[model samples]
Target: MEALKKLFVEFLQAPTQENFLKVRNAVLATEEFDPYTDAIDGVPKMMEAGELEQALEVMKHALFPNLVLSPGAHLNIAFLLHKLGREKDAAFEHHISQLLQEAIEETGDGTEARPYLVTRTSDEYDYLFAHDLEAKGQALAKSPDGTREHDVLTTKDGGQIWFDVTDIRKVLARRMESDGEASE
Candidate 1:
């Protein structure tokens, strides 16, 4: 666990884009992820290192157990994989998207990489746009729009779900850091 933490921190600390990608690939090979705690910590840490691809791969892999990767992971891998031009694989993943959606509803938590599963009843764009706003500081009006923006996880139908970083930041800002730490 500590090694995984160190790997993530190292990935975050590197200065060059070259080294960052290298470390990211290395971390993906490590095959260690804990969603509730470690995987959650690792994602931002990887992004901090500019290893979004690696972080996604690691998280997607962590989301599965056998059959190379799970259905949800395949969907997530498909999304990212498409960005990387892995179309055939992505098309293959399309088949499993519904199963992934079912698993997500069963879990009731949008922690999985990609959980959206659309049906004839609901449109994907509708589900996607619903979460375009964030709620912070007060009332769940909408999310931020600038650099502080975060995405809302959704289903294929586009129903918005998952953590919103904008709100997390507000809560953290209001929190006291430590016993001896100042509140400034």
Candidate 2:
């Protein structure tokens, strides 16, 4: 656990893409390394190869040390759990994802590598956009000239721009739809 914490801090100290890759490589090279990246990478490949059990195992063993990586893993794990007809487990994963989202929103300035925290709705949306996790059905209202109209939400933390409750709903809906299709 200490080594894992060290690695986590090192990654946070320099959160750049290049630095992340470097640290990831180092972790992979270490004999004591948890197979976090391997598991994350193998999931899609295993799924594509119809190795459902293997994919599920990979997701189940994934370790998340921070919110930076937790949200995506939680989302993926939730989907996989649902695919396996484990509705309760999937819901737990989704709840974890929501909690991680909230944590990210409340986190302070991150390391020099990734300094910005998604403390506001606009920032969170931007983070999702960058990660290709944008809420699918929550289209922003656009003007005739194509500029989006900003909708603000005030939370106890501060003012968040372009906040939409539908974003959260869409995320839940996506998981539900995936399960629904699997059930059918």
Candidate 3:
């Protein structure tokens, strides 16, 4: 997150086309990157071409997981979801977009050196999960003992959404292991 904040600050300070392309290319070089091949990289164009389902699938799966670090990407997804009559999904993406926008705004007018903070509080996670369940008109309940302790959210229809923090740690561990293997 601090990396993203720094990137945004650098872009703001320079504000050149070349700088923009450089930043964009850096993002695209990430392992999770996927090209927006349909219609010049704009979601609106995909919608205009009657590819709403494809657009939604790409935004939800491919883009959201990878591009959540980008405010513009969130905004684009939100706009596309709204146009496709998915108001709840749009609202969630808009919330994320606003959060990213606030992070950028807190960087102080693009003039001075500002400390970028990447603090993830429990409240933020609670808010995200709560809003998601509410958007689906489902109630959230705690799972009983003997189940996966990380299974935090259970819906009224017996569906579960597990948000295990250890999962992230494992992913990082795997990445580090792979990186070490590559360097060897």
Candidate 4:
């Protein structure tokens, strides 16, 4: 995990496709990687409680240690920093968020045939939020041969978007298998 952490830092420093691939591969190979959770999970509640500083601290601490490749965490941190009057830091985080987002967008267009690739479900919402859209519904889908998985989102404006969430699917599958083994 420490080596994976270093890879993530390196990728943040040089956010290119090659660096991202390294991080992605490392994440996928690790059984402990859970794309469903992040340190920033508590931020919204903290914000609602007016504990901005605490929320920011939680986000920073969890940013790297956790498998949080989603842009939403950075965006949340940026928003918190901006609210705290740290424009420079906020801008930097916002930039990082955009870089991560661009990496996902470059994977494919948001169509069923060519869905945008994302590591976490939060990223699907981030992509929609970035486009000023809202999801009216969501469903999991698979390729015709059942080799690939996707998240098909129906937009409020009666449109649809797609995300290739294969990594997340794999993570969930592994977790389910482990749970079954534990129960037995």
Q: Which candidate is the best by TM-score?
A: 4
- Per-residue lDDT for 19-82 in model 4, tens only? 8878877877777767766556777899999999999999887765343576888898899999
| lDDT of all predictions | 0.41, 0.49, 0.48, 0.84
Order the candidate numbers by lDDT, best to worst.
4, 2, 3, 1
Candidate 3 residue 6 C-alpha distance from true site, Å: 22
lDDT of 2 by residue, 1-184 (tens): 4565465566555544444444433433343333223446767888788787778777666553222245566677788888878999999778656655554543333222223333123344544543445343333343345432322322233433333223333334565677799899
Clashing pairs in 4: none
Mark the regions of model 1 whose C-alpha exceeds 4 Å error after superposition.
Answer: 1-37, 40-53, 65-73, 103-184
Backbone clashes in model 2, listed as residue pairs: 15-113
- Stretches off by above 4 angstroms in model 2 are 2-38, 64-69, 108-126, 129-184
The 10 consecutive residues of candidate 2 with the worst lDDT sum are 111-120
lDDT digits (tens) for residues 90-148 of candidate 3? 99788766665555334332111222211112222333443454222322222344322
> Among these predicted structures, which one has the highest lDDT?
4
> What's the CA error at residue 15 for candidate 1, in Å?
45
lDDT of 1: 0.41
Question: Stretches of candidate 4 above 4 Å error?
Answer: 65-67
Error of 4 at 147 (Å): 0.4
Of candidate 4, the 10-residue stretch with the lowest lDDT total is 61-70
Order of all candidates by TM-score, from best down to worst?
Answer: 4, 2, 3, 1
